[model samples]
Target: MPTFLKPIAPWLVILFPILTLPLKFFLKRIKKTREILALIVPVITTLFVSSYYSLIVNGEVLTNTVFKMNNILNIYFRVDAASFLFAIVSSTLWIFTIIYSFGYMKEYQNKDRYYSFLILALSVTMGVAFSGNLLTFYMFYELLTLITYPLVIHVQTEEAMDAGKQYLTYSLSGGALILLGIMFVAFLNEGVVLNFIPGGLISKSLLETGRSLEITLLVFLAGFSVKAAVMPLHRWLPAAMVAPTPISALFHAVAVVNSGVFGIIRIVYFVFGPEIVISLWTGKLFLVLILITIVLASIIAFFKDNLKRRLAYSTVSQLGYISLGAFLLNLEGLSGGILHLFNHALIKITLFFCSGVIYIVTHKKKISEMAGIGKKMPWTMGAFAIASLGMVGIPPSVGFNSKWYLMLGSFNQGSLLIMGLLILSAMLNAGYFLPIVVSAFFKEPITDFEEHQGFFEAPVSMLAPTVILAIATIGFGIWYHFPSLVVEVVVQNIF
Candidate 1:
């Protein structure tokens, strides 16, 4: 909040992670130092991002132009309510994930390279959050794909390599569509200011015929939808589960998926504005598509035996909820959508973390193989159960609160079908997620697994974050006002 910090705050948040990348190489020989540095850098970065809380809540916009290239391209940063919320959530979660990674990656090779790209991904994610314009967001968005490819293929197996290739194919294709959309925007309005304006920067005169508007909007939506994992385009997600568990937890469940939907939010509220979206009738078309993703992904998740892939499919479904809320175009809907962005991140990451612990402790990837895992890893499965319930929108877990608002938003829009879909999606959520909790707790242990005593949980570094996030699932649900405060600010500005 300091006056001098305004210009430099955003860059500092990003640089803290990048600055550690070199030290990682310099200390490559010392594993302990590298690990500690990995934990400490993200802590510092999260704190720096949190420092802007008051600024954003007070409705102040922080903009810094790092570089300007003619009129079409530039490096810029803006910290508004939306960006601040994303920056803080991702940075804060990165800390726990790094801690979890210590236990998860202890025996793995190339510790230095993994940690380096891990840190670099945080920097790039921050760039995506704070990007001031479509061009800046696009640049960082593409960088994110490149930075994460190594992580996806860290195991270097044939499956991992194939998954990496699929990831690149989907991501680069999406990026190309996004670039085409940006070029169209530039062409339609020569020398147009591309900075994100809450009400939208596209001129009304250009939208008279609505044809150009519809085409550009479709291009942008289709481009961003690939990353958003909007079905047909979501295959890369399940395939990329070949990576390590921590990567699945933080990147796939939280950072990477959010970036895609976050881009769509920018396109809707910042680039086109809600009015334009509604006026063009594109909102209805995209809303139907998102609803399909919501239901279909949940149904698909129910059948997946692999825990990570199940969670991967669940992420696809949950992302649809976020998109559904945003397109609702009403205050309650946007509020629910934006709030779910944070709530789902917390809940889903916990689920993934629990899955990681189960994998590390039992080497069991399939749900059918995890019978009675709860007895052996009580703390881990306990956390997983809580998160699973939350995912189903049960009370006293944060997921219920966001879904509540989304339903309200649907009602406000007079679309009982959307409200019905929301209800049906919750049923599907319970259908898929609740059974895992039930099987882990009640079903007898499988014959192939050795019998264990009670409570053989994962290492404290891994177990602690899972438990903490689980507690947060209920805690934040009860104390919903905390996150709602920020979401309120975001909705107020956008509406």
Candidate 2:
């Protein structure tokens, strides 16, 4: 992409989140047109942004200075391989999400505010992906958490309100930690131009002094960990499950939480040089924590009975795998982890989207209530089955490939026990996901479902976006090799 167009791609990332503000006012005059307008803007922006970066993928880092405000504040952006990868993921999947939300939110009032935050949330996410400095990234990251709060509490009930408060509290605390990390980084890099350079700008003395490197890494990890839903920091996620399905779909799938995982990768590889991080005890400790998170979250998932809550816990377990790969401190682990970012994202989103549709059509939240739902919403629930199988790391889906490479990386680590934990987690994965498929398809329908031949699924808007995502999940699984190529390129060129 030409450097000029490169700047525009970052703009597209925030197109949704940014527009939401004005959209709220526009609805005073434009009212219901907001939905059609919502569909048009994000879709157009996604296409425009993707094409711009696709042009420059050959061997160039597209950079643009959006503003040179001052020494303290600057408008800096760039489209690198990493930025291109994440921006496209959000902008594209968000297009489908908006479509799904249209029918999903049709009956709800106050949609003006609803779609408004949806747009703003997306826009800031783009900002997070394309940010050029610690300062800029922190700004956008906070914006994402703040803007999505309305969506989290869209239902306006006592439970929804409580969930929103907890979400805000946790997310804002994360923002504070991130801000502290940014100050330390800026304090270290006082006069240098900022870029996603390998190894941070901090001096060696600071890194070695008083376990500073370990402490700094922990601050960033604790900051980013809240959203990534790492163990002990993940209570907010299941609590936030009280929101409507679309909100859950958007936030958990790729918007709110993905930003956290994305931030960890960006900080690890871009902020602290991978080599420096690996040489320190802090990095090794984080790796051990992620491995423990993977095993433990999977075990917890096995015991949850609420549909969204089970999936909520499943999200925690999957994120552990992503963290494990990122913290492994090698190419296989990094590549596997990065690829899992996309793989787990698509599959997990599909699972949540389908779950949302099931509740909308059936008024059911527990897995047991979904018995025989397969007969009602075959296409909808069928995708759920396929996605569940994929979650269990079954073949012919994208999740299988992620698990395969993750295990390969574990084996590469020469730890026979980590390899065992990998297998055990998959079995635990099956323990939660498999039963849902079995309950919906193999078992008799719940009594309420027996007479409901009149309906098979949620609205076309809801079911269509979900099934499409399910298809993308399977398709993206097999396409894992393509990202492997990109990861090889990142290593060869950047490292």
Measured over all alpha carbons after superposition, the RMSD of each candidate to the real structure, in angstroms, is 1.9, 2.8
* Per-residue C-alpha lDDT of model 1 across residues 230-340, encoded as one tens digit per residue: 987899999999999999987665679999999999999998888888888667788889999999999998889999999999999999998988899999999999889
**What TM-score, computed on C-alpha atoms, does each candidate reach?**
0.96, 0.92
lDDT of 2 at 285: 77
Q: After superposition, how far is residue 421 of candidate 1 from its true place, in Å?
A: 0.9
The per-model lDDT (C-alpha) reads 0.88, 0.77
Residue ranges of candidate 2 with Cα displaced over 4 Å: 1-9, 12-32, 69-72, 203-206, 450-456, 480-482
The candidate 2 region of ten consecutive residues with least summed lDDT is 1-10
Clashing pairs in 2: 1-56, 14-123, 16-119, 17-119, 17-120, 17-123, 199-273, 398-477
At residue 71, candidate 2 shows an lDDT of 49
